[model samples]
Target: MATNDYTAILNELKGEITNMVVSSASAYADAAKHDAQALLSDMDANLQTWTQQLATGEISAQDLAFLVKTQKDLMKMQALKQAGLSAIAVDKLKNDVINVITSTIIGKI
Candidate 1:
């Protein structure tokens, strides 16, 4: 059996996260934008699996949120770190990304 394609939903999430990072860190827009893409890229495989599970009713919204939050520990956002964004700023950006992920996931359902 073929798995359902989730490219559109993932793309939508990527666009939202990229836009949010660029706007939220105007001073480091370029670096932040790159970070956003990298973060999404790192999460790509898990996202595909989770999104598919969510769509198939194999995972709850809460499960998706929790799973995503757990991935935060793995998010380095190297560009943001190298660009001298404060720890607080990086944390905020991570939170924003999580929010975007959750919101985007739910909105698509």
Candidate 2:
């Protein structure tokens, strides 16, 4: 079996995640800007720890999936809170975000 150099994978994943978050934030409304910025800041704080864990073999794809899910949930909730979106509308938007993130991350690996 060919051993994958997960350090490189993790690094690429991190960059992709950062890009996704930044682009999403850029599209936020003025009222939701603070929440989006906060989300990015939080992600930045954890990026180093996450990359280190993955590089050291302390985490796996499943862990990354969970992280991505949680991040998506938090981001959508924050946006909803700011936007006062209807439940149905929030669900639709959340699903879209989740799908995009999942596909982007998985496609990279």
Candidate 3:
């Protein structure tokens, strides 16, 4: 192939790769956001249930407070876990993209 042909192909490949990376990253972020929201909703529901139980004499005030504190701690841990997973996912995506681009360029040459 001519120089121009190779250049054109490489440019097209680069554009496609860029689009893929952007779309993938957006999708991952959306998924992470959804998961976080779901977690929050669940925590809210649990807190409500606990409060109701306490009002009904099912649990003592001390127990309620402890439960609430424990739940809050769990939520914090879950959030941290999610953030760590997100970071790992982003790193993996970066590495995968780099590998793909490198292989493509190597093959082209």
lDDT of 3 by residue, 1-109 (tens): 6898788767877886788778877987898889889988998899899999999999999999999899889888988987898788778778877777787777776
All candidates: TM-score: 0.40, 0.43, 0.79
lDDT rank order: 3, 1, 2
RMSD of 2: 23.0
Scored against the true structure, residue 58 in model 1 reaches a CA lDDT of 100
How do these models rank on TM-score, best leading? 3, 2, 1
Q: TM-score of predicted model 3?
A: 0.79
The candidate that wins on TM-score is 3
Q: For residues 35-102, what per-residue lDDT tens digits would candidate 1 score against the true structure?
A: 78877886998999999999999999999999998887556445446556756667888998898888
Q: Could you tell me the lDDT of residue 63 within candidate 1?
A: 100
The whole-model lDDT of each prediction reads: 0.77, 0.67, 0.84
Residue 65 of model 2, lDDT score: 71
Identify the runs in model 1 with alpha carbons over 4 angstroms from their true place: 1-5, 27-85
Clash pairs detected, candidate 1: none
